[model samples]
Structures are given as structure tokens and as C-alpha cells.
Target: MKAEFATAERAVTLGVRETTDGLKMSMRRQVTSAGLGQRMANTWRGDNYPKGQNSIRAAGVVYTKASRIMEGFEDAAVIRSKDGWWLAIPTPNAPKRGVGGKRINPSNFPEHTYGRLRFVYRSGKPSLLVVDNARASYNRKSGQLRGFRKASDRAVSKGSGLTTVVMFWLVPQVQLPRLITFNTEAKRWFDRLPQLILKNWPD
Candidate 1:
């Protein structure tokens, strides 16, 4: 999960007596800038920026640790549950944040904060985790169903507005489509190598 650029080869081509350290620093800046641009593009969810650290310089080579995530943009990826269990896909009604302000999943979901959840199986469709006697209210600002509250006995009675609200969908696998322009950005920065070397040429 890395991209390595041999700085020595480019430095040789440019006939520069500058140190590889200078060129490596220049390349690091460009790679950092490129990563920032991708983050701004809003291709994926959450803050994927720091998940992959900035580029590193080693022995005349500059590389990045963002390969695994960037590779998904180059090709489609099928993600399966790590524990051989169904993947819980959160629904709009599900809480967005869990403990430590991270995205909520079945593992870290605050069930007690919401209500008791039950599984509902479907004959031909994915099974769902739902709250039987809960009510959901929509938030106009976020455009999502939030404010899940337990229904009182009278509210759960007939003609009551309380209904089963879906929290998550259980699926075996999920296929992620190609979204980011990783190769394009890589080539762009690669093409600028000559200029970068000159810019950071040893003073």
C-alpha cells in the first residue's frame, strides 16, 4: 500500500548536484497537497485523509502509505465481514455517531441510548435490525431520521403513530465502485518531478 518514486534517477536526468533530501522534501509537499485535494473532492465518507499518513522519504525514494485506499479507486473492491458475520449497513434512522464521536456500526452502536433492537428476517431481501416500539422524527437540517425515542404503552396501542423503524441492514458483502482519480493524480505529480527538483534545488 505505497507509491515510491526513485528520486536519484530523476535527479540524474536533470544533471543537478542537489542532495536527494531536498528533492524528497519537494516531492513530499506535492504528495501532501495532492492528498488534500482528493479529500476536498468528497469522493468517500468520513475523514480518510489521515487514515493514510503523508509520504515518507527513504534512501532516495519518496512513497506514500495510502495505497490500499487509493487502489480501490483504480479498481472495484468487494468488502466482506472480517468475523464471517453479516455486515451491518446503517440506515438513515440509525445514529450517526457512537462512543468517541466515531461513525456508528452494529459493534459500537449505543443500543441503550436508542432502544431495544430486534432482528426482522425477509424471505427474499436482506434482514433488518429494527426497533419495534420506537418513533423517529426527521431533522430538516440534516435530512435524516433522528430523535429515536421509546414509545409509551398508550403510544404503542392501536392507531398509535409508533411503528417499527429500521436501524441497519444485514448483508454478506458490499461492492465499492471506483470513485477517486488516484492514477490521474499520481501521474500529475509524477510529471511535475522535473519542476519539483528544480524548485527545491539545493541552495
Candidate 2:
């Protein structure tokens, strides 16, 4: 697969202080284009983690975004995000039916994976969330559907013993911003759209 991504500078810190809308926090955004199976990896890899360090990203997002180095290797950091939502840059790897390691049902994919999206601004802050029936974003080719992640897809407890949780973007509305989603079958945690999870990963 092929991917194209660009970083955007100059993000605004909307609420670190205050706002006309009285919204709190900051908003940073950059547009990226990933080929069918590319762009899964974050732009800032290798610089931090070693090669083939991709699988870890998925495990990490199950917790939170922007990991901060809490201990262990300098690369080991605590995940964090500015907005109420978590922001993570998953390292891209090959696609598969099961993840980390587990079998899955062929149905309940994009069709039933995501749906019932709703969004609104709290305290004048512009925010949004999306509901996707697509458990995971799959290449819309004829036979490639299965190649995409299925609802039954899973990330097995590995040498590290990490649980593979999925993450997806929320519904986007004109009054609200669209939450960008990542992960195949990442919608499993859809009910708790932005309920930030702090993962104390063993380094």
C-alpha cells in the first residue's frame, strides 16, 4: 500500500487560557493521505522507537494518545492528548484478518462497526464526534473486504501481555469537528467515544 501525509504547523491553543466561546483547550490538525494499507504508522517513528516497533503502537492506543516517557527506555513515554479526545499516530503495518492474534467474524464490519454519530459543543467550545459502522476502515475492493479488520478481530496478549483495544473517530458535524478514527475494528470502544484511557504499559 502507498501513503501520503503532510505535517501542519501553527496550531491554535484555544482554551489553555480562555475563548470568545469560553471553550477550553487547543486544536491542532494536519491532513494525511494513506494508501489502502499505508499511513498507519505515525510520521515520527524510528526517531523514537526501533524498526518493526509498529505492533506496539496499536497496543498503546488502546490506552491513550501522545505517550510521554514515564520511565524505562527514553522512548518509553506516557501517552497524552490536548483535547478531551485522545490523539495517537498508529504505526502502519500489513493488514490482516486477526490482529495482535485472534480470529474474527466476517460480518459487522464497516456496515455495522460504526453508526449513530452525534456531536455538540460544550461551553461554547467547537467540538464534534462521529459514529462509524465500519469496525475498521477496509480497502473497498471486491475481495479485500475480508482483508479489512472484522468486528471479531483482536490483538492477543503477546510477549508483553497487552490487550488490543480499538479506537475510531467520532461523527463530524458543521457545528462540531469530526473525530478522526484509527485501527481496524477499532470501533469496538465506540460507546465510550472519547473516554480517555491512561495505560500504564510495562516498559
Candidate 3:
């Protein structure tokens, strides 16, 4: 939500011999960067998707700090640091009692909803791949304990008949990233720039 820019010194080869038309490449770079930033921002906002885009559909860690995109020009982008971990977890709505009124363990539930976690990094170094259950819920307000849910105190249950049960617990679920789509969209945005700049260029 805030406008922030992080400068990344990338080696750019304009790919053309020196000429009076160097402006074309420079314009291309700027437009490309802006396009990429907008695409990434849209993804973060969960736009341009259909059918339960907000649903948590898998269990496990899908993203970490290292996987974060590090820089953008007009929108906020993740800054690389040895200080925190970002995790994606999938959680389902709730589960009901099975046969014989037996309480099902939350772990056995098929996770179809997703959320994310941000963890504070400790020690002189931090890891991007270290996943420990004890450390996973290291956040003070993560997960559930006893009969208390950290996210919501109200108990809600779904389903009816012999499948009715109370909604309980939250756990990690995973969501896949659309890196390919990001690249495609970014390229499409960038592809239109030449004509745009030519139209704006002085006669």
C-alpha cells in the first residue's frame, strides 16, 4: 500500500551498437520495470483470478524469504534481509465428525485454503528452508491451543446429518505461485512500449 522504490544495480546491455537512438532502449527499460511492478502488485492484491481465489487449497510451506521478489519502482516490493521468514500455509474451513462421533485430528483434514506467515529472524544468520514445527508456530498469535482459536474465538461448524461437527483449529497450507504468468503478463505489458514511445517521441 505505500509507494516505495528499491534501487537494484543491474548490469544492462542495451544490445545495440551506440547510436543516436539509445533513447529507445532507455525508454524500454523504464517501461518494462513499471510494467513488472504493476503485475507483481496486482498479484499481491489477488486480482485477475477466478473461483475461490482466496481459498486455502493445500498444506505446507510454499514461500519463504528467499523466494520474495526484492525490488520494484512504483509499488512496495520485498526487501531482502537475513531478518525474517515469509511462509504460505493452506487451511480449510473446518471439518466435521466422521462415523461413531469420533473427533478428527486437524492434521488429517485436507487443506484447501491458504494464508501467509511472517516470522522474525533470530541469531546472526537466518534460513529460508528451515521448517521446524516448533518454530513454525513461533509467532505469538499463531495456531490454536486447547479449545481456543487464535484467529477467532467464535465456534462455527458446517455440514449436517451424520457429518456435522464443530469448526476447529488452523494449520499451514500451501499455494502455488504464478511465476510463468507473471513473466507472460510482464512481457505483454512491455511489448506495447515501442509504439507508445514512438507516438510520444518528437517529430
Candidate 4:
């Protein structure tokens, strides 16, 4: 007599689906633990280190709006101005973004609000946009300069405790350092994928 074996096709399919779900869950947990979520939030909101939302997962892919920034931290990258002009690196004295997220530059800076900005050239060094006779406003608790106070005509004429404040530093390019071990972190989680699948195996 001969014996024949039949495959449990439905059970096999269910097992595979369960394993996939578990792997996805594990990946989401690992990504959250990596602190990328907070980084993305900070980048988007222009805030200093706050709790962030979870990463977006779609069709078996994980990503975020700050993905390019995260990738830049994986390796040294050079950033330059898009207009072939000097990059305007903001200083403590620079005004914050204007209405509608418009960048405060020399051309568009609200002169009425912060006084006129003057350009200062330096030999073999980055140039600067400065405000004369202006005082910097600082946070009382943090002591961080928020913006420059527009100096009155009287103050400029009298030079009454007046000071020059650097608003923006103009540079051709800036180099970013490798700040994150992206591949290493991903590999650490990837190596454990088999375990994740096994743990999720259907009963």
C-alpha cells in the first residue's frame, strides 16, 4: 500500500500573513525607538526636541517628510544655495520667518520692523548682514536671542549704548557631518527579522 500527503494550503497562507503583520509591527516599534519620529517633528515644526508622530507606513514601506534629512546625516553631505548665490545662514540676531513661511532675507526683510540691514564683507571669511545700533531681544528664561530690536533714529544719532548685530552669514556652501548611524541601526533591527517572524508564526 502507498500513502499520499496533502498540503494544508489555507493554514500555510494564514501563517505567512501573520508573519508579515508581525514583521511590520516590529519594524514600526524599532523605528519609533530610534528617535527618528521626534527628529522629524522638530524639523517640520522648527522647534527644539518635542514628541513627534509615528512614521508613515504604506504598502510595506516606511518613510517620512524628513527622510532626506535623515539620509544626509548617514553620510557627509555638502549643501549649497539653490540660486547660485551665497547661502544665508541665519544668526541669533536674524529675524524669524515671516508670514507664510517667507524667508527673511536682505531683499525681503521688514526694514520697518528691524531697521535697515547692511552688508559687511570680510577677507577670507564669510560675509555678514548686520544691523547697526540694534539691541537683541532675548528669552528671559533661556537667555537665547530671539531677534533684533529696531534702533530708533535718536539712538543711532546719539550712539546710545548702540551695538552692531550680525543677522546672516553668507557662505557659498556648507558641509554636514555624519551624525547618525542609519545603516547600523537598520541592520540591528533587520538581523532580528527572522526572530520576529518566528515569534509571529501562527499557532
Residue by residue across 88-178, what tens digits does model 3's lDDT show? 2222323344234554333343222211122334454331221111111234576553221222112222221111122332223223332
Model 3 residue 140 distance off true place after TM-score fit, in angstroms: 38
Using TM-score as the yardstick, the better of models 1 and 4 is 4
Minimum summed lDDT over a 10-residue window in model 3 is located at 5-14
**Residue-wise lDDT of candidate 2 within 10-115, one digit each (tens)?**
0111111112111101111111322211232232221212222322222212222232211111233344454545332221222232232433211222323333
Which parts of model 3 are misplaced by more than 4 Å? 1-180
- lDDT string for model 4 (1-203, tens) is 11111123333333344444444444444445556564453332211111131111211222335668756655768999899989888885676774346986667777677777788999899999887778667899999867678878887788876788888899999987676554564455556545554553455
Model 2 sits at a Cα RMSD from the real structure of 24.8
Report every candidate's CA lDDT: 0.60, 0.26, 0.28, 0.60
Candidate 2 Cα errors over 4 Å, as ranges: 1-73, 88-142, 146-203
Task: Evaluate residue 136 in candidate 3 and report its C-alpha lDDT on the 0 to 100 scale.
Answer: 14
Candidate with better lDDT, 3 vs 4:
4
TM-score of 2: 0.17
Model 1, span 1-203: residue lDDT tens: 22224344333434222333334344444434556453433332222122223322212233345657546544778888998878899998888897668998776777666677788888778889987777767898987865687776677776477777898999888887665454554455466656755664343
Error of 4 at 130 (Å): 0.6
